[model samples]
Target: MMKNWLAAGAIALTAGMTTTVAQAQSTMIPGENVGLATGAPLPEGIYAINTFIYRSQDTAAADTAINIPILVWATPFVPFGGRIEFVVAPPTVFTFSRVAGGRDTSINVGTFVGGLWAFDLGGNVGVSFLFGSYLNELNAGRGGGLNILASNTYRAGAAISYTGDGYNLTANLTYQFYDTPGRFDGPNGIPAFFGPVGISDALNIDLTATKKFGKFEIGAVGYGTVNLDPNILVFPAGLGVAPGRLGRGGRFALGGLIGYDFGPFSVQAYVARDVVTTGPRGVESTDGFFRIVAPLYTPAAAPAPMPAPLVRKY
Candidate 1:
């Protein structure tokens, strides 16, 4: 049947594209910490963060390199009782053994303006909503696969968290609308099989559960993405490829995180592996990452009142 053929083609196309864009486009977003919700905005303050991501794979000869340094500032409250935040992340990437060319490194930047609304329901439960966009930044090169900067896109999401005596649970869902970045149209280029393929919208989800032990917290994190549209439509009107395909670009991963809090600063380390595939198949990636966050400026904590001097009854 025609449907079966389209499904087959979609899988093949996704496999090919995976090697090309694996690094530049990912299920994870910058400024988002493992086991943390993207929709949960930070308290009013300026913050600086460094995220180092190291990834390894079996199929390709080269590994992926990603380093992101970011600065975020959030306002106390906005007109609608929500917080407005801005983020700037400059990421450096290195792609190994690329197909279009060879190996290369590129530096890119991602900027976002977002609003977050968080409300407490009851019993230590809270929910949040986030809406933002990644404005014009450098798109990934055709061959390189280790880019961490998001392609030009808009995203919105919501999150919910529940805290108990010594444990916490958090989950979030987000949707992305990608802008069409034209494909390389040349001999042995991507356009031959599918001309100017337009990317479908995607949905991303993450969940985390942690148990707190004084200043140290340990948690498990899981995340994945699914393309909403079933097919990659051909653009520019000349490619022979049809519009129907299975769109098997979905991917899932699981990881663990350990974090330590230091009053005004925090550090977290995480390790993750692809659950569905190894290599040359579904999304193949094994990544270890760490993040450091510190407050740039914040109001000093109110000092405790002097203990009432014991009254001498005599």
Candidate 2:
């Protein structure tokens, strides 16, 4: 029964931690394909689809997560210029966890919806503002305590990007505010055994730098997250679980990416290592991700050619 308890405790901790991690996972911008200005709106009447397949191994807990998220980007027929865009991502997750000498698995679904406004600052520079939220009510495996979705949370952020002759740079910053869900019930659906839990607000940052090479681009990506209140409370915490095991501290990752553009379509692959972990109890994961992006609209018109150079008269 020790194995059962280990699985149960792991599940309980996962439930509390999923809120922040899920929100961050849903907000990922597919920058490997589009670059760092993920918040930039598409042109009017343009639509694009992004599909991601991610696999992560959590070494600390001996757990593995396979996540697939699909996002749709669209610019509706608004009176304003194509400066406004909407995004919706629906994510499905599967996790394989080792419990004592055996393993258990669970599946869940989550949703994120948001909008962004992009503005061209001229000189190959652009900026965007975004607002969005994650809704965790649709998950089905929470009772198992191994779900990968989080509760309700709101997010807002901004991104800035620059494009030069052969390189691109981008940075994005965001803040997430979490809501109190009161407590979590374990596999037995008993709160008295599993105990109450809470989540703290978090701040996150993402940075990318890529160099263009004909149709291919190579880049480095880095991201980090820190809880706003490091001393947040997790009830019944002395049960051998770490104090910040429920998403209360800082986590960071760094990776590299390669992408190729095929006219209106693009594909990118990336691998990342969790450099700074949240502690021995928190997850230390190595992640691999693949993304496909395609635009479902005709290409925009090219600018008119410049007038021919004047010939000197003798």
Q: What's the CA RMSD for each of the models? A: 10.7, 10.6
Best candidate, lDDT: 1
Task: Write one digit per residue (lDDT tens) for candidate 1, span 1-314.
Answer: 11111111100000001222322233234214444434334556676677677766756666665666766666666545545655555455555554556655443434444545655465756566666655534444232222212246566777776665655577777777656553544322222333343555666666777777877878898866666765544233454433344344566679898877776666778788778631123446777778766767755777999999888876
> Residue 213 in candidate 2 has what lDDT?
86
Give the per-residue lDDT digits (tens) of candidate 2, residues 199-300: 566677777777778778788888777666554455346435554443445567788988776765666677777787562245566666665555455357
**Could you estimate the TM-score for every candidate?**
0.71, 0.73
Highest TM-score scorer: 2
> What would you estimate as the lDDT of candidate 1?
0.52
> Cα miss at 130, model 2 (Å)?
1.0
